[model samples]
Target: MILYTPLAETDIFPVSEADLQKRHCVSHNGKQLYVEEMEDGQFQLLQVLSTDPNDFMNTDYIPGTILR
Candidate 1:
């Protein structure tokens, strides 16, 4: 597979050590979530890892929603 874009590779796929450290995988409401730690000590939802389609419909698990 090849991507033919004028953007630099970093611009397309950025990876920062600090960003990685700030992110965590946690279980919430019996579902796995990828979240980033916020300055307020809360977590911002990044992605939902689940097979159930209904899990994605839950408001609490929406991307960008803050979690305790």
Candidate 2:
């Protein structure tokens, strides 16, 4: 696993590099998909996404300092 600092010149995400720039963390239960805010003010899904990619960013972040 690659660990990137928030201040890193590169952007890091919970999922694969392809799925990095995502804002919603999607979790599926059968036919239902649950997507939550990524990097919410409270880091809501950080804990969840950190462990599983099932609910991960759907968008990509630009390489630099990302506030979220």
Q: Candidate 2: misplaced stretches above 4 Å?
A: 1-49, 60-65
- How does candidate 1 fare on TM-score? 0.78
Q: How many residue pairs clash in each candidate?
A: 0, 5
Off by over 4 Å in 1: 1-11
Cα lDDT for residue 46, model 2?
31
lDDT of 1 by residue, 1-68 (tens): 99999996558999799888999999987899989999899999999999999999988898999998
User: TM-score of every model?
Assistant: 0.78, 0.16
lDDT of 2: 0.36
Per residue, candidate 2 scores C-alpha lDDT tens digits across 1-68 of 66657663233423565435454454433212323344444222332323435334433321232233
Once all C-alphas are superposed, what RMSD does model 1 give against the true structure?
5.3
